[model samples]
Target: MRKRTVGTGILVACAVGLLVYLAFNVRLAPIPNAVAALKTVGMTCGSCAGKIEKALKPMKGVAGVEVDVKGGWVLVGYDTNSANPETFAGAVRKAGFQSWLMEQMSLADFRRVTGRDFGAKVVRSGGCGTGGCDSGGCGNAI
Candidate 1:
């Protein structure tokens, strides 16, 4: 009789714990102070942008993602402590797209040149072959 009462109490406690876990939403702190601008190859359209975002969005400490199809570049805003230019570049590589890091700049410079916050806008234009390198072969991807 006592064992049954104890087991019932344990089950109720577990149920309550599970409910609390389901009810609370996990919050990730945004790290938005630095930007990693990378030059990409073989990225030709908005679909390419989506792929890049998919690769980068789940990375820890990444705050924002922006892709410029017209320019063949991807800009990632992230927390310096948790991610760096290499983290973004490596993820793109794993996603099967190659990337060359252009520069890592401060959020101020990024906003100044882009005129907006990361993920707030994207530059999608230019024809394929012109999209990533080969604008008469842009720098030969060197």
Candidate 2:
């Protein structure tokens, strides 16, 4: 009677809520006006870049991370209020690589010298037959 009506109403509300949740896409909002550029030394291959990315991407306030293996540069977009360039540099160092701030003038000069845009997005996700070799040169981890 009354109990059955209340249960039916609750079930309908739950079904409507589930529909709404499944119909919409949820994502994190991007940060505006914050980009950190780091000159990373010792990135010899894509795996190196992947390791660096894996270290920095989980940090708080990091919106996006882009690595340029050929240019030895890492660009990180984040919220300026919660993160800074120094944090990224430290992460790179912790991952066993030296890093430094690429000043505006230096960045421009590097771009000119390399004749390639440094800001291009990097794709470091593992692919078929992509892996690094050990010091003994046993073999690549393909």
Candidate 3:
């Protein structure tokens, strides 16, 4: 009788442990697919980036926000089910910054404004006329 009771208690303990393990290991739903990038204009300094980041950070469904001062762009990652690009654009405009959907801008214009070179450099050692490059290399200034 004693051996049977001990065996039954061990079985119950094992069952409870398995249930707990399964509960913790179960996978949840996948994250939504509403991520997008926005290009902001008229941002001249780091302070401008801070203002834009602060404005968008509090909005719902915003997963992440990055402001590139040199690139004059704001990249936003969001959940489409909860928020849309139009809403995000509105938030940027309200902060006194000009913003447009990244898709609207032409690739050529983006490269020009950001000062990014897509092709080989004509001068290997010399910097661009815009003073973006120096002895250290190309600075982040755009």
Candidate 4:
């Protein structure tokens, strides 16, 4: 009957609208023009990711933060005008996580070199030699 057709049409319209909303919200976030990829360590769970995010999100020029818990990366999008990677490293330290700036470059280069899934091959700061770290030399410079 006409009532059934009207109901079906309304259901279809709602489904399409829901899909559109998800398409925007679920899509990968756009990387900022200037990004710093920090090879993160000691971040084991979602709570750890939240700690890192809380540390970086309030920074002066930090634009975005993407934490890959499994991949062990903390991708921080920041403005070069008022932000430096050094401050970011400090924040991570305060949050009880170890992070070192692996690369500071354009979005294109970052995109080319890394992915959100496997950021395993990144170079660590490792301020100490193979002898082992003395203080916090493992994450930041000694």
For candidate 2, the clash count comes to: 0
lDDT of 3: 0.61
Residues forming the 10-long window of minimal summed lDDT in candidate 4: 117-126
- Candidate 1 per-residue C-alpha lDDT over 42-101 given as tens digits, one digit per residue, 9 for 90 to 100: 676556677778898888888888888666788888888887678788888887778878
Ranking under TM-score, best-scoring first? 1, 2, 4, 3
Predicted candidate 4 versus true structure: per-residue lDDT over 8-106, tens digit per residue: 999999999999999877634433568888988776555566678889987877878888766788888877777887788779988887788887877
Model 1's TM-score against the true structure: 0.68
Q: What residue runs in model 4 are displaced by over 4 Å at the alpha carbon? A: 1-31, 114-142
| Cα-based lDDT for every prediction | 0.76, 0.67, 0.61, 0.70
How many steric overlaps are in each model, in order?
2, 0, 0, 0
Candidate 2 similarity to native, TM-score: 0.58
Tens digits of lDDT, candidate 3, 1-142 = 9999999999999999999998998644323244456777766555556667788867876755667656666766556667666777778888877787764223355356547432222112122343534543333422
Worst window of 10 by summed lDDT in candidate 1: 133-142
Deviation of model 1 at 70, angstroms: 2.2
Candidate that beats the other on lDDT, 2 or 4, i.e. the better one: 4
Q: Per-prediction TM-score, please?
A: 0.68, 0.58, 0.49, 0.56
Report RMSD (Å) for each prediction in the order shown: 6.6, 6.4, 11.2, 9.1
For model 3, the superposed segments whose C-alpha errors exceed 4 Å read 1-32, 104-142
Q: lDDT value for candidate 1?
A: 0.76
What tens digits encode model 2's per-residue C-alpha lDDT throughout 51-131?
788888878777777877666788776676666667788888888778876642233454566564434545453332322
